[model samples]
Target: MIFFEDTVSVVKVAVSLLLALASWLLIRFPAPFRHYLNPRPALTLWVSFIGLRVIPFIIVYLIMDFAPRSDTEFFYKKAIAAFAGKMVYRDFLSYHGPLFGYLISLPLYLWYNAKILIPFMAIVEFAIVWATWRYYQSSRPDALLMAVLYFLLPMPFVAMILSSEEDIWFWGVGLITLAYASRAQGSLWIGIIWGLSMIVIKSMIIVLLVPLFFLVDNKFKYVLGLAIVGIPSIVILYLLMGDAFLMPLQHSGYNMTPNIVSITRPFLSGVYNQISLTRLNTISLCITMALSSWAAIRYRHLGYRQIFPSLYVLTFGIFMLAQPSAPGFYLFMYMIVVLYEMVKIEDRSFNVQLILLNFLIVIEPIIWVIYVGMLNYDDWHTVFSSGVNTADYLIQVVEVGLLLALVWRTFVHLRSLDRAASQSFAASSQRTGSSPVS
Candidate 1:
């Protein structure tokens, strides 16, 4: 039995590696296959979308029974309990927002079995693709690519859908919010409601509202819409749960720290130990906020089209690093935004970097498993052995490098737009023999 289990683990790892390799190759050689892969016809587009998104999800769902149990089981148990009149905070200690437990409980209402939950989650995945398509005004090919990326991208598939983390729902709703918020002219209520819904799902998502606020035309309506939903939700939760309502707030402050920090932990020795995790997290948060605020203020003058990419970088990019735990799925939304922007600007270099970064992230689990020798290794020393620690360190270095590259590219893109606008104004002034400003 032990040998058979070890063999199964090996097979799983090998399959995961091959999948990652295939995705890397496909991304690396997208052009040669674009003729066939890119959807030119409406029928082809829809077919490709279904094939890319639905089929893989179905396969995962079918095999969910055979897959190793994870936090999803714990969440499913808690969600079922919540449905049985158990309060999230009072009945059970939960680090997550109250709504997440309730949200996961939704699938249970439809079907009692946990396996059925996979298909429901797949539907949410489809919604994410739809949201991405709408948000970016994606071409058929682009939409198909988004679906493929979301489905096959190992981290998203493994950590989110397969593991059944509520982050997937958070991401789906967040994208929907972006879809509505990105519109130039629309009812602000929809965007505001979705935005608040995202926050209610996970309060950490509140950072995203900063960019959403700038995306829409009517700031007052947007803010009012948020207040409309947010104020009442808080009041009701407070009235019902009282002190338990503060649990999410309190939980947010606890510094779980990232695996990436372990890379330096050994080298710095006593020096690293001396610095408070709370202080480090606070400093990181402040830096992220300052940078995002500066960008928002500077780019507020641009048109909605131009402003969207900057807003993505400011909100999602900062949120990626600001969080205590560095889950790769956190980058899923940012990856979509970056890909959309990259396609718009035709920045192939940055696109390649993004794909490579994703591939690296997806493969980290392999190293993690090899170093730790199983998914549930509890000892800190075993989990963070020299090999795994070094691998994590390198992965984080690459992540940081890719992120900086993306930020630089965004800056360059914005600067080029500014230069073009200025040149157009200069030419118009020369033709008219007077400047409108003067």
Candidate 2:
């Protein structure tokens, strides 16, 4: 029965990949057929928003069994427990932020069930689609395109809203904050507050804030805004939970043996335990920080809009690499960055590469699902305990390959921009009959 199930899963995956490739070919080639998928701007926007964001949740809820040991169940229980006056840090040892517990608990306040949380998250997904549309100042067709892509995108649908992961909420808040940060007329302070609020919900989201310094006009106001919200929140949390307030930070570092770092155990001499994993993560983090600093300095002149994607990819990519586990769901951020860049860049090769990269990103999680299905277990935790399989190692390799591809493409794009700027400056100097400055 297990072999039969695994074979069926493999067949399904093969068929899906073929269909995806065929669809991409059709979209890229036949000009007339392209118009067939295109609808009126407003109608497309609304349809994509509703169909992608809401309908999938309904479908998943009806189709899949909500596994008892799933992340959603874990969160639901924590939310309920927190709402019942249990201290999240002291009592539950939650690695999640305080605000996350309170936020998830809101759905339980009305009716207690995991299903109820879907709609709450779906609403946030709607906000993300809308904010993204506005952020790009895209045409109705472009807005519809983004909405459709996000909705149909496998990464967001499968890893996030389908599982009711908190990252979906964090992603939405991050998008809204980015939208505000990018606008010339938008308030930096408001963006700062929103960014800080995202951190309060999931401290990992603090990585998203790195780009805001480049995006915002007033650095001082941005710092002030962060301090305004951050200082008080920390003090209050400390007062409420005492030293337990620091538990999330500690919990964040706990090595979940399945991460990129742990996958290297076969190459190393030591046992693959938490302490070793933590040390590996520390080394990864240091490398990431150094590379990120160099990128920031080298690309300092790029506009906020242009540089924002690199900042996101670099920061989040590092976090994922350094963290104990790389949940396929988090790739949704990569999807967002790549999709936005695809729309913005005119280079056909770059766009195609981004499209292919997005496809690979989508495939990773599906592969993970198949691997888990092969385990034939009702409890999700059992699959983790069963140890890393060949499939797990394959997916990690795919992830690293995709990350390198994105980083390479970003650097190439930035260098092209620099070349164009230099050429334009030289031309202007010639026209003015003045030697170009050294």
Candidate 3:
């Protein structure tokens, strides 16, 4: 009884439905054959994941030289800036820190007339792979799967590699490196390495100390030791960079000015049409921060040391949202958190939190995409005409959602453990014929 157009709709819906079912199967099913799939005894699983990320970039670059329409202008301007040894200013161009522009354009400068971004892209991919691999030496299979999801379904690997944001390498590699260095080595050295991550990209690497403190028992000493090294280094970097350092901050503020200014403007007033449209983005930013804050509070009851990993993810996610460059940058950190929590099955309530968070991840972009894809949709005409496309927005929605879910789940699981301990203490007091200790 379905008409031709209805049949087309059914097919589109069916494909999406099948893909969702497959993802669920992959996540829910046991990896009984994981040992076989991951058969290299010599190399760790993290190493393999790194290879998975890097190899694709090399192959893809060979196949196509075309920069994505979204990133071509960024690539051109940055390349020009680095070679010319001058500042490139755009009131709206704040997706990445100045570090990214300098880093990406350096190779092209050295080559004098060659395409340097591609090789640099390859290096970035390699760094991300290596760091992400290190991130998972002891990481659970579920977490590993979440990482893979970040690479494949949620955000195309190409999108990450080509984007001017070099922090992907810092975050993807730096987080894993910090995890290994802190756990395997001692605090002073780990603190030093973490300081480097901050220098490379401040917001991306600041949270590494949180998980590091938890791994060690001497909480105050470890924190003090890290701060002893980290704080001064940060201040020194700010002093050294001066105007260069301020550039990233200026860029960030300019990007957010429209949204921030919109807050004072009325939503539905005829004069406020421009401001009202921007308000849609502000809601997501606030929600992302609120959820992260809630998770951080729930995670606090876990000993100061135990709270780092959660805090690291929560703080990073919040920073990304507040920075207001674009959805993709925020989603990148979200992907990391989601994967970290998905495989770490230490608590009963984690699954529930994960499912809800994932649903949110999946919903945010779909709304944006549908808005752009359909003429009948309220945002279709506006969003599409601008350089922004619906598909990428959908990707960001899903990626951030997954990562947020991971943090929420981790917080919930830790809270459940705390509750269980409290209950056990109460039961013991009851049996001992003593009043339950207040």
Question: Which residue runs does candidate 3 get wrong by more than 4 Å?
Answer: 1-25, 28-35, 41-60, 68-76, 83-100, 109-135, 139-150, 156-158, 161-165, 170-195, 202-244, 253-305, 316-329, 343-407, 417-438
Report the alpha-carbon TM-score of model 2 versus the true structure.
0.76
Residue 271 of model 1 has an lDDT of: 60
What lDDT does candidate 3 reach at residue 35? Answer: 46
Q: In model 2, which regions exceed 4 Å deviation?
A: 1-39, 62-69, 85-87, 91-93, 109-111, 137-143, 168-191, 208-221, 253-263, 269-275, 343-388, 420-438
Two-way TM-score contest, 1 vs 2, winner: 1
Candidate 3 — number of clashing residue pairs? 8
The candidate maximizing TM-score is 1
Candidate 2, residues 1-438, lDDT tens digits: the string is: 222455534543454455355435543553443375554655666776567556655665656644322567778877888788887687775667777777788888777887777767667666666666676645334444555556655456544554665565555565555556656645455456665664457665555555455455676777677777777777887788788877765644443322455445555323444355457555665666666656666776665545655566666666676565445446665566556554442355644554555555555444445545433222334435544455555555666665666666666666776677779889999999998985
The lDDT for every candidate, in the order shown, is 0.58, 0.59, 0.47
| Clash tally for model 1 | 0
Q: lDDT per residue, candidate 3, 281-345, as tens digits?
A: 45544555555555555554554334554555555655544434344334444445455644443
Ranking by lDDT: 2, 1, 3
Q: Candidate 1: misplaced stretches above 4 Å?
A: 1-13, 28-33, 37-64, 93-97, 137-150, 165-191, 210-221, 250-263, 267-272, 343-349, 365-385, 417-438
Which prediction has more favorable TM-score, 1 or 3? 1
| Cα TM-score per model | 0.78, 0.76, 0.57
Clashing pairs in 2: none
